[model samples]
Target: MEVPKKEDVINEMREILGNNDYIVQVVNTDNEVVNLLDQESGELQLEATANIFIGGSILDRGITIKNILCFFYGRNPKNFQQDTVLQHARMYGARKKEDMAVTRFHTSSAIYHILSRMNELDNQLREWFLQGNDQSDLNAVFVGYDKNIKPCAMQKIKVSDALTLKKQQRVLPVGMWTGSKTATKKMMAEIDHLVNESMCGQKLDADGFFYMNKDVAQQIIALIEDTYVYDEKYGNIDHKSDMRELLCALEYCTERSGGKLRAMVRTDRNMTRIRANGGFIDSPEDGRTDLKPARERALHEPVLMLLRQNGQKEETEYGNIGWNNAPFYWPVLLTQEDLAPVMFALDQRRKGKQLTIDLTEMLEGVNPDEVLKLSYAGNPIDQFGKEGTTYANAEEAAVETRWLKESVASLFIEKDEQGNWKHNPAVPFDEKNDHGVYSLNHGHFPFVLRDYKYILLRNGRNANAPLMLLELFPKDEWIIDPRGDFDEENNLLDDNGQDILLYGSDVIYDKNMNKTNFEDKSITLWYIEYPVKRVVKYKCLKK
Candidate 1:
């Protein structure tokens, strides 16, 4: 394959951006040709303005470009490291609201999908950190299993862990024959009773789809192994193991989606066999599509589709292909894409398969016996306890730690008039529910308005909390006063001297905390704005 020259790419970019206010600079390791830095102090000597740098790996990692309104990443390696791919995300970090609106990111669909999944995984890891999970405690890092992509180099991750199916992935049985006619008939009858009798109200939809709870879905999955038989004579996927993994993925999704999933029994399909005596190949609907599935309009839910094929072999136009005369249900599980990557913790030591650490490779030239032991800075018993600091009890230590973590609400971030991001002192707010207290600020902060129901509880203390905090739901009479402004003492008030409060409703309250009859209230919040639309285009690259 012929690689395009850097000069050609630069010239093309120059032609496209021609004579604009933007400045274009080519930055690479070839400093001899185009020098932009001082030799003595290593400081950038270029003019201070909006500049676009055309370079390869040089723009990655530690490189920082302020106000990066546009980013075009096309680097595609044969293999990808999770860290290396993430570090190339130079567009991350603080930016002014105006610049952020025009910010654009261009990449291939494959790369875009990979980055989106990685972003979800990264967010999960961040939540764990925010809940005070130590690095050592985070033993399992869930990564989508791709032959080209790895979590990192094997040497980087010292431990060996078993891989599991990633979230939002589709799993279906491939290359399999059906069970005996006697067995399948019994299985079908059982399925009929289970769906119609056991699950009555949740009947089959108008489109042949049946919405079932998590337990019912599990029951349907259990019937697959008995009805669809994966012959041992042929090299086929392990039915038991695959079913278990599919169930795991289902459990993860259903738990988040209110224990609901739509199942469809797709029957009378003429799916031909792969080879003589081999199981029938999958249909197009068996695979996942970017479009949302039926019954469950929520994009963040799972779908279970069962294929009931005509179990009879005949001389077809293609060849003598089809399953045996035993109609069976082949399960295809489509997982939810919006959830965090599913990871399972497996203790290899418990199974007598411990991965021994090679000290020679790890320490290199250092003597293993003479290696000094480094202790944790904090007390081993208490996570929040620091060295030389004493607490009366564990409760006291926890309280102090919670206070320190919540201290960030004391200030809010906003952009100054010069289009620079800055922090301002925030007015304090404290609200308590069954699951401890939630502190918010009275100053403007960046926010993305989303449906309240789908929001996952990330706080550790609220791990077992309900999806919706009932008390926080807005009341009918509660309305925010649009004309309300903070007084000299930081107390929000309207023009008529009614105190503005957002605790229960958006309406103004009296000194005794009773809502007034002012129906002309409007919604007001110290909230941030986001762009209404985002455009992502795909690039089809040829070898």
Candidate 2:
């Protein structure tokens, strides 16, 4: 493909502008660049005249355009670098109130959406810093992740613990209980009635599907919150805390998307308590990956999927995971893709030790679109040096199953044969290892694990290990680093699209409790699309 000549570019701009009243200058590397700096004084030089100047990376930084009343940005690169993209905000800075009021930004809808999310993230960071928020008080700094948008240029970043929430992500709660059978039955019936009365007209193509406004969605969330019970000890769930974060993210999205949300009332799922591959709940009836039809219909809004389980009382393979023998509704919140492909820099430090997210350095670049195609499940236990594997026999499986029912202490600490307290051999626990069990659930059981190795290295672990740092995904799947590949410098080797990412097995248990063909063979970084933008403290689960 031949590049268009400068004359052709000037002609096209002239035609688009509709008139040749202003001089069109192609201020590029080949052309005589417009004078932006005084030759001798080195001060800004330019006449207060009306002229149209077009440039590329040259205009990305260290160059200012005066009185940018109307900006027409149309650089359609396949991948966008966040730092370079933000630097193109030459239109920003102090301006006359009247001039600012009249200024307008023009870009494609795709570019506009990502830019809007980036602006929100930038503003959030600025607000926290300006308000004199202590570094210790900070949680995570969120950066909207998009397939087309790269957070920062590759090669520039070496190592980072940046947590990501990808676009079009779904988050569900699996490790939870729905009260007693009677209470669950009553709650389910009441919710069914509420949906029939309020969301009947908003039905989608599916039988139990409906689209709702923020008001109706809030009602449903509240009902689910009231009916659900979570035991932070064995089960890594806290309905109340999760609900709060959900409501917060919902409000943020509602303000932008006109308060639209989708819901599905799936009944009689009969899903097992412990699903394969870290799923809190099983797939939709069609088994087409978390009800793809309903998700596509919403386009750019949250989907509140309510699945009613069969409430089987019989013991599951992993034994009873504390769910009461009663039919209950399981709610899964699917945050929209409009504000995704993001990262959060959370200060998970407790009791003030001085740790901050340097937004400039923490940014990373990866083609998340490629990552989203693979269906990978994260095992939180993997971070503790335990590779996901299958049970050799039912007896071995039962031993691990019993651990799931044990206290939170059992996860990391255990009593030896002599009944002496010792660090669990499974976990490589050390004073230098800065890991915390974050109590925020995003699909995977045991909630999100905080691994701020960089932060904790300086001060070391506290008396009580304070949970910090987390990553959320947009889709139902998780991010995987299967090869266990790292650079010589010990940096995570960026994905080059060669590795095969396995999809959909939370923990590779021996199928049928017998060592079978399927045994987890690799380690992966688990991420779920989480919409909670700010860092909020959740009580440590005590068994």
Candidate 3:
């Protein structure tokens, strides 16, 4: 078998190659050239490859000039599977000098054309190819090829291979931090900024971002747990007591809308001594002795009365009234009507008599006219007339008069143009005058308003005894002038006849002989204002 010429083999190989095969071989040779060119030009270049096949007896006898020419003319050059002779002939021909030069030139030129197109493409899509630019355009171009063209897959595979090769040669530089502490702090600050920024835009879901950073989440959880434990251990006794008192007060206020009683007993007296002295008494000394002594102090009880109805068929078919519990030292009975049923039941049980009295009839015959007439007469009144001039003996009248005088005194508050209140003078007055009036020469005409119910008036410095001692009358006792005002209605008489209401006003008279002035007077007066009832709910602690 004669070997084929190089020119013949080159022609045969070209004839045997399909379009894809030829392009692939061309790409392979072009890739080598591109590497060489990249090194020379200090820039990247594209690469590609090509493949070819021959058939029948020509390929089996190996290649020859005649066979090569035949293959190029579209003949079945060889079927390498059926005849090794033709395959060998073609192989021998492909190695010839002329064929090598021609093959190399053809592949090289193809590569050059492909590389040129690539460079053109690179320039055309410079923005996409450049670093720091959006890679979306390049991705979009590749996606378009994948979707619209059939041979685009092969092109993409080739491009990917080229990219992999280029990336292998490229060396990435390493970075080092010059100042460790500063760089670490900067990085931490950046992380904190990012965390805060992420949290700022939305409702913070602890489970989401908080828990995403495990270390931070654990720290927060620990802090919260510690706080909860601390709170649980040291319970707030004052707050709890305050809450209870508030609730009780609210309940009392709800039950009694019109009026209520608040009582405070002075515990300074020796209660044990009094009890011991009274216990040694042989018998009731007098009718007064059976009654509790007035000196033996006891707190007043607050009571709420409510009316209830009974069925018509019952023998005592009437609305029975009762009193609700309140914060008090002793039990309280509200009205005369509330006392009748108990009295009647006790009488029946003691006497063992089954006498059924018609309560309604009995009540009707009780002569209410006399009782109503005597009601006003039995009330206590302030005897302020000539030595023994009897005033109206009515408790209600007295309380009304006192409340009126107090309310009239509370209206004036001397405020400057800026609405700021001026300070009141703090002067000690001689509390011994019989009229309960004191003279003070503290540069200002200072007058003190004392509780009329419990004032201890003194004439001069007597250290031992008050000149005119007054005691706190029960709320039901004491006269309150309904029309007394500190200004035009009931002005204080100064020597010059000018009204001397002065700067301090809005006075409160508690049962404890304490006077509270609301116009920013002495610190004592200021402190009293703090305990005043400002809201519907409150507590009264006896400290």
Please give the TM-score that candidate 3 achieves against the real structure: 0.12
Candidate ordering by TM-score (highest first): 2, 1, 3
Best by TM-score: 2
Model 3 CA deviation exceeding 4 Å by range: 1-380, 383-522, 526-543
Better of 1 and 3 by TM-score: 1
- Which candidate model has the greater TM-score, 1 or 2? 2
lDDT of 3: 0.24
Judge candidate 3 at residue 210 and give its lDDT: 18
Worst 10 residues of 2 by lDDT: 451-460
lDDT of each: 0.48, 0.48, 0.24
For the record, the alpha-carbon RMSD of candidate 2 to the native fold, in angstroms, is: 18.4
lDDT of 3 at 534: 11
Candidate 2 stretches with Cα past 4 Å from truth are 1-120, 124-165, 182-189, 201-208, 237-241, 276-286, 316-318, 336-543
TM-score of each model, paired residue for residue = 0.35, 0.41, 0.12
* Tens-digit per-residue lDDT, 121-149, candidate 2: 67766775675542422233445454445
Count of backbone collisions within predicted model 3:
43
Separate clash counts for every candidate: 4, 23, 43
TM-score of 2: 0.41
lDDT of candidate model 1 versus the reference: 0.48
